[model samples]
Target: MQEIVGYPLDNFSLNLRDIVDLIYFEGPLLTLFENEYGDSYLYYWCDVDEQCNRWLVFRVTRKTLRFYVTQKLSLRELIVNPVDGFLYSIELDDELQCQRCCLIQPPNLPPKYIPAVDSYYDFSKLDPEETEAKGLLLEKIWDEKHELSDLLTKLFDKPPLEMIDEPSLA
Candidate 1:
């Protein structure tokens, strides 16, 4: 599997160690899908605490992943925009460290929903076993390692447009 450089955990209050623990040990990937532009969106179920369990979706661009793999960016720089959710952008200083991050609120959204945390799945009341089982099943179908590598290979190595000549007119 290709090495992963960064994760989109900047919006959260987690430190590097906590982020790694959450990703590798605690969180279970729920699903993954690619957009027409070859960008990958991954959803993960995180058991943040005894009282809080939520879902997070990350939008990782091909360029961003490339930058991450090359060590040009840190995991905190990855943008975690949940599906049909809030948007956030991060700025980095010359030292390649995060400078400032802001939530890009949509104008149509109400002020009460500025952060829009409600869009994500909150499984605080659900049974963990069932949720995790479903998550594992999803992981099996859209295996992150294989899917990501395939998408990255296509994005980086394949031609942007396929040219097929039209059949000769009779």
Candidate 2:
């Protein structure tokens, strides 16, 4: 196993919570399927189009990764947040607390463990445990999100305001 003395700024650290939100599974995405019920699973594409949000609809199939990004969303913002995504949402045991599952260097490292100054990374691939962990983290974050309802309003096929009514004339 490759030790982390120093790693690149863009390295993936995964732990199994299976939190990713799959899009292909929702209804046969890309040209892969036409079924309305073919839900996207762990193995799907992350489509990135200029006219779409900078989101990833990723999947791992036969040990190969396939991803597509949206053209509509700014590519830079994707590293932080995307309408759809591939990320980790760390879960605190406390019901009200929130933490992000991250791979970045720990703030306080022991004297023995030298933080790698040189850029290094393992691009070989992610193992099963890692995949499951990231997905789980994303799922947890999705559950605890504070603005889900409002975001959904914007995502709906109908306009955000059309589905609601004016305040009752009480």
Best-fitting candidate, measured by TM-score?
1
Over 46-131, each residue of candidate 2 has an lDDT whose tens digit, in order, gives 23223321111222221111222112222223322322333222223234132322232332222222222431212112233444
lDDT of each: 0.38, 0.28
**Highest lDDT, which number?**
1
Q: Give per-model TM-scores.
A: 0.28, 0.21
Error of 2 at 140 (Å): 4.2
| Model 2 worst lDDT window (10 residues) | 62-71
For candidate 2, what is the total of clashing residue pairs? Answer: 35
RMSD for all candidates, in order, please.
Answer: 17.4, 17.6
User: Which stretches of model 2 miss by more than 4 angstroms?
Assistant: 1-15, 23-146, 158-166
Taking the tens digit of each residue's C-alpha lDDT, what string does model 1 give over 1-170?
11112334455332221111112233343334454544555434422323333333456555554444344554434423233344433333344354433444334223332232323322232243454433332333343565544533443453223322358999
Clashes of each: 2, 35
Give the lowest summed-lDDT range of ten residues in model 1: 14-23
